[model samples]
Target: MLWEALGAARDLGRVHDIAAVLIRYGFGDLVQRLGMARALERAGKVLHLRGQDDIARLEPAARVRRALEELGPTFVKLGQILATRADLFPPDWIAEFGKLQDAAPAVPFEAIRAQLAEDLGDLPENIFAELDTTPLAAASLAQVHRARLADGTPVALKVRRPGIRPVIEADLRLLARLAEIVEAEAPDLRRYRPREVVRQFAHSLRRELDFSAEGRNAERIAASFADQPEIVVPRIHWQWSGERLNVQDFIEGVPGRAVAALPEGFDRRLLARRGARAVLKMVLEDGFFHADPHQGNVFYLPDNRLAFIDFGMVGRLPEARRYEVAELLHGLVDRDGGLVTQVLLGWSDAAEADSESLRADIDRFVDEYHGVPLKQLDFGAMLGDVVGILREHGLALPPDLALMIKAFITLEGLGRQLDPDFDIAGEAAPYLREVILAHHAPDAIAKRGWRGLVSVADLLAGLPHDLARLLRIARRGSLKLEVDVPPLKAFGDQLDRAASRLTMGIVTAALIVGSSIALTVNRSDSVSLIGLLGFVGAMLGGLWVLVSVWRGGR
Candidate 1:
């Protein structure tokens, strides 16, 4: 574990900082429970705990969001990831997490130019014709600047912030340890799956830090839409791209957020429809999509085309998962509660839940949306309601699915922003139908049947050997069976502790009895002194036993 003594020593300063933030946010109890307080004290670190009561007056969710913000980029990104977990948190918590923004003050141009020069193997002037010192945008990990190539092609240069890797790495290390502590010590927070969340976030953040990976993601998405002239991804200038630097064609169009600034002839409704269809195709048809499609990541070009940028975050759905999603969406539209319930249960990787209760809830939800016009229906709200039900039933969507849902919600919101009457349900209908039809086609069934047959045949071929091995193990008396029953194991641990305490009590009593007899038979001062020492030792041992019992009682 990263929180082991050796590893924690290396990160003692970071631990102190994190604990200080938590305490300042009125989470000192959490800090103590996680053993951070004890560890910090052992390292001789003083924690400032003043002003906590004032911060405690704020709502818990708000306090957590503020703490994350203060903790810097890694935690802000974590909060953003948490914002997508509708099935793990209630609406209030999710809303608070959504408030986290990635904006940060830009690193100075002089420092950036030094890194850029090293990355480019020469000065910035030697590569690009002109590079602007002013940053176009600055974010938590990187900043973008406008530049022009030698041939006069305009481009945007995305440069990783100098010395960011070490800071983020330290934060990630502390986060890993913190997640472990929360999982082991805070049973109430265990349902949130802190370890799994941190693991996913770490993987995602690392991939995002690699500018080359973002370039590759952009190319892949661009290739996916090569035949469609309406959707555009910036052409990657890989000659200058690397782990720390990305160069791509600059998009010179109306920013997606500036709806009022669109050229006089641009059609908002058409743009909305096209954007929705493009995202649906990526998700349902291509099985890969942009995880974040917010206004900042999109631009509007002439002829009503859309330009999507920033491939830092994306989602991929396997073939099986794509089909399941299609089924779920089809069921929702058709008001088939049973189908929806089945798809949901299949997605839940937890222990069996109350299927009948879940089915009833799904039916009620479906009925609530029944007869609603497609144009008037709120698809995002519907998805949120479904996720709320899953939350109530103690089920959470897998990480990929959670990202997909968040993307869908963002897409719908963007659509409505462009056109007041935009209908995501109507726009998604055709793509969903195609996916469902493709899954049930005759060729698809035959392909699945052939795969299943191969699996069964392999199993049959290996059956005799497996049985022979099992028989041999049994004959040698080496067979083993293991059962994991948490309650019984817990009771056994308690028994072990109680037995140890009882043994200590018996030893203490024996010392007291022997010492009392020695005191009565003492003929010299030394014997009496020895007897007195024995009595003192007995008293200390008795106190230990009493304290152990008292603590165990709680």
Candidate 2:
């Protein structure tokens, strides 16, 4: 009945379209292995599925990227998320997925005029001094236009596409169903955790679709860095923001990617250091960070202040995880391979492997770089190497933890692009040091100890009740213990058969001895019944033992 329900769901949702798309990209085997081939057959018969003619000509990574792009926004977002998972995917695959584009044609302004006016509480003319119909940027989810307030304050107005939510919501449903099917049907994919990845993607998409959520994120991050004059986060105007639309202060600065086009006299070195410091602080201290800090999402103001945009995807860590990560980085600094190994394993419940071997691998990674001075070490290259090792060892990080790795990698890349002598390690060292000190501080230790003692006391308080319940069950003769013993069952049976044979041999020996003694003593008593009976018993026992051995061997 459960399978039937799943089958019906497969037919009802977009699984058919999804399967057809996979088949077109030469991923028909994946579809079959996921137990969706029957649905694919039905879809194929209806749609007359045709594989891409030149699919075989492309590399596997390129094929995957192309398939995702053709599948639409949800899959593209999945690809984008996968691109951040450097510790799971190969470098080539990550590179290919990084190219997943969400660009879409702009929606007509007339179509969204009502939504915009509604979100803003009035028409554009009534609420703003001026508004531009032409979009400053367009994407599958939303588009932004340049606007100005009645008080002459410049702002960026983001408008959601007229009917995109339903489409995205439908795709999300199909993806959730498909993820469940994939996890259940394919054991090899279990380690990759397709279900968990999809869950994270769904959560992220929910946050992304609501412009107000993004506004809130911007506000929180802005507050985190409020004291730092070197960094800028756009001010969100909540009065005009809603689930579908957002309004924020317009930033007038050069995009970080176009460093060559910047006017002369700009201090690239200063910009690079400030950028690295800002991001490092966010990860190691603030515990909240913009996960995507690629060159495009950054802007450079005239005073060398760096601005971050796009709060759609963010990463957060609690204090505990933050401390662990900081210690991991510090381990890298001190060349403490064991500490690094411990921290990495603590980050996720990865498959068990040889801890010594993993530690050795970390030692090798650190030894190759830690000896070099901080400023001279290639931090980006070292990080890439670590990611490769992690993938090889099946130590893929959880989604939120992986985001910090990606963020740091992005910051290093940006730094290197702006200044060849950029020092990521140097910039991150002080923050990590502070975290490490706090981690071992006396007050922190005492607090942790108190928490542990409270947990132990709670357990003690419940011990008597648990013991009474167990004793009551045993007394009532209703105690049942469930155990896994398939491996032991055969061994137990063999031991039982051996013990029976040994007992039979002992009985036979005793009978023989008694029979001999009786025969000797009754030699003159002609035809003694006791001796005859003893001999018969011995013979019978011997035969039984022989038969048992033969049967057991067979």
Candidate 3:
């Protein structure tokens, strides 16, 4: 580990040099914040000093943006993620990070040729009828060169830069270690879990490095969107693709953002709607999304179809959670804060349940903001408030959920940029309504009921054995059995509590029915006493069951 750390440190020095270029280009603030403040200060001692005012005059956000650009692709990608995490970082940092693009200095043709040969086991000439020596586009991870197969099929050859993986791996290891150290030393840092963040970054970067993975992702996304002709995903050329290199059918279209510069034929409004709808469907309906939907990854094809590129990062939600998400969104749309709180609490772990506090917070949040429409609500602000409440109550969301939230916000922001009037809430209404209807459909209710009945039957079937064991233990000189008696006892306690709850429900229903009957019958006010007593009894019984169940859990 020490040797690895030292090697990583050396790699870190190289990264620092790259970062220094960014810092020199007016991104000193971002460079410093990327865990290089001390190094930057040291460099400053050797390279003359600039006062704080001078640094501020350079514009902190622009400085950070330049630094990310200087640092190369991996850091640029990191900056994109940082841009979305408005809750974690300041607004200025988020704004600055958003400007950081993944454009990188292109490797020389010789280096690209060497990498292609190493990956494909041949020179470009042998594998292709023609290969463009000039790159179509150069990015941090890989550069694309337009080429054609021997069969005369036009393709794009994406060749990874020579020896890029080692640099990325080394930097990731250093970052992971740094995270561990920070988590150990700073309690606040522990909340973010530096190691986990690095791990996620490593996973994302690793996928990007392996062109085969990107190809697979593209294929899967293509399959998901097959029914939607307006959306296009470039077909991967599996025959010539390898882990380090990717070959795909070359997409001939301008970027979606660049459509503004194109001829008047393109329908910008329709294009924007198509892009937003495609992304929304991926996130809400399909539950599998192309994580990066920036302008560069989106293209406007002929016939006004929207094409998506780059599948390095994707998000998926489990089917159950996806259903819950549908419900949560529906609740949001309906302005039912209680339902939203319930769904959120259900998604949380048992350890996080502080019923009193959670209920109070939900009540407050609902009272404060329930009537506001989705268009009027700032999703980020709402999320921040909820996160703040959860933090105060010592609750934390699972990492995947947090990532999903980040993805959702990113999608929203991207959609807004494309179409300022794009109403995500309105667009999602039909989809969410379908989900809710499915959830509450008669068939669904019957299915749930049948499942519940089966569970009850299973418990009843076990009751005989349980009772026999109890009797046998009572008959024996020593009470002994292989059963996990504690859980069984808890279950019995729960059953008793349930019985108490049922009795309360019955009594409450009777009271309501009797009161209505009395009102209709023109009975005197004194005649309502029986209903009141029944109501009180029901309340006491319900409270008793709650206390019993709570104690049993303890």
Rank the models by TM-score, top first.
Answer: 1, 2, 3
Tens-digit lDDT string for candidate 2 (307-349): 9998988999888998998888878878888898898777657
Stretches off by above 4 angstroms in model 3 are 1-71, 261-269, 342-420, 437-554
Q: Which model is ahead, 1 or 2, in terms of lDDT?
A: 1
Return the candidate ranking by lDDT, descending.
1, 2, 3
TM-score of candidate 3 on Cα atoms, chains taken together: 0.66
Tell me the deviation in Å of residue 453 in model 3: 12
Top candidate by lDDT: 1
Model 3 C-alpha lDDT per residue in residues 1-554, reported as the tens digit of each score = 22334443455466556555655666554444444544433344232223345555777577667666766667787787666554356566767887776767777788777778877777778999998888888888888888988998898888888888877876676567667656654665555556776787778888889989999989998998888898989898787788988898888788756645766677666776677678767776777888767667887887888888888778777656777888777665665767877876775554436776787786777568766766666554566566556655555555456666666665566566656665667776777777667778899899989999999999999999999988887898567557554446647866887787777667666766776676567666676775566567656756776776664453
CA-RMSD of model 2: 15.0
lDDT (CA) per prediction: 0.89, 0.83, 0.70
Clashes of each: 0, 0, 2
Residue range 1-554, candidate 1, lDDT tens digits: 23463354666777888889998898887777667776776678887666556787999999999999999888899999989999998999999999999999999999887889998889999999999999999999999999999999999999999888877888887778778777665666666678888998999999999999999999999999999999999999988999999999999999978977787889999999999989998999998899989889989999999999999999999888999998998898889999999999888765568999999999999999889888998899989999999999988788899999999999999899889899998898888888878889999999999999999999999999999999999999999999866557658889999999899888889989988888898768888888899899989989999888875663
In model 1, pairs of residues that clash are none
